[model samples]
Target: MSELTAFLSSNVVFGVWGGLVGLSLLVLAVDLHQKNAHLSPMMKFVWALTVLYSGPIGLGIYFYAGRKEIAHDSIWRRGFRSVAHCYSGCGMGEVLGVILTVGLLSLGNLWVALASFSLAYVFGFGLTMGPLMQEGETFSDAFNDALYSETPSITVMEVVAIGADLLLAGSAHMGQTLFWGALIFSLSLGLFAAYPVNVLLIKWGVKEGMMNPKHTPGNAAPQTA
Candidate 1:
């Protein structure tokens, strides 16, 4: 843990990397708002939030893999978009749960993990249901869709995040830089862990994997499944 702490404390290197990430996030967010207004709000939010943690790599992927110019994306690209969508909501909720439980409340690891999982499910389901609701689906129907589509990926992400947190011993106070660093690292691992689950979900027709401009209420792109 001490070694990890020392590594993260390398201010010169971390500062440069952090600056690049911050710039990438800002550029992506602005581009989404100004140029990609036809995209669903959720997707715009996903790309920006993905860049927030994944940094330049996320930025590169967004430019190379997420653009709509290709017209028909491969299954892998579609799967990545699904995972990014899931990660945006689940990751944010997990971070908030950690802040509330561990940072503010100073709870034990088990309680923190539980609270994080609970919040992750809440955000994950809410994000998934939002687009369906926009398409005039009833609340119950949207809820069912979200439950079926989001549960497995969110579960895998939360489990991986918890494991990463434990392995890294990253339950520091919120005021500390280590807190954010640890959360970022753990959540990134969670994102990677959930990717295969999302691909499977796409393959099984349990989740939509298309990414296209929003010409209609729901996603306009065809589902890969």
Candidate 2:
């Protein structure tokens, strides 16, 4: 506790910034739940998490791109949504894994990276499969779909995020501003890195983009221009 106090006192800028981020997340989460109820549960969580990390910029993006209703999902828009969806799960897993393995357990670098990657895959695949299973698909079928659809994006995201973390904060303690700052930068880069891959996947019909809440797997409605 005293160490945390010392860290925060020394990093006043980061402390203030973290406070603002927490406030932004609260606002975004409420707005999403109350006004954007049309979004899927997964999407709502994604948007909230995005805002939590990116703060005002993320909130602006949600208003500009996320809230608008698209009768036809352009390739670019579809790609953006796809990346956000994948990032939601992958980012959470990676951060948690790092916090647990690197921060808490103080594992070696290789072990920390492996643990982060493993958790990222698990959460990423689970998010993709969960909705399908909810809609009555067998576990085997849903797992296969998730494996095919999410693997590439998740892999790209994890590589960039973990690599950036290692490069930027390899020896920084968890309480250091460098650690969280590097994580935010790395996550943003990871999102961009996954975007093009997601676009390619959408182009190839390997995965679907951000789904409307009304969409069901078997009875998906066509988008209108």
Best by lDDT: 1
Residues 60-163, model 1: lDDT tens digits: 76775566544566767877888888888888889888888887789988888889999999988888888889989999999998898889999999999877
Give lDDT for model 2: 0.78
**Whole-model lDDT per candidate:** 0.79, 0.78
Give per-residue CA lDDT, model 2, range 1-225, as digits (tens): 345433433567577777888888887777766756656666778788777766776676566557644354477777877787788888889899889987889988898799999998998888888889999999999999999999999999999999987777777778777778777767878888898999999899998777543452333355899
lDDT measured at residue 149 in model 1 versus the true structure, 0 to 100: 85
Q: Which stretches of candidate 1 lie over 4 Å from their true place?
A: 1-5, 33-35, 213-225
RMSD (Å) of each candidate, 1 decimal: 4.5, 5.6
How many collisions between residues are there in candidate 2? 0
Q: Whole-model lDDT for model 1 versus the true structure?
A: 0.79
Worst 10 residues of 2 by lDDT: 212-221
Q: Estimate each model's TM-score.
A: 0.86, 0.83
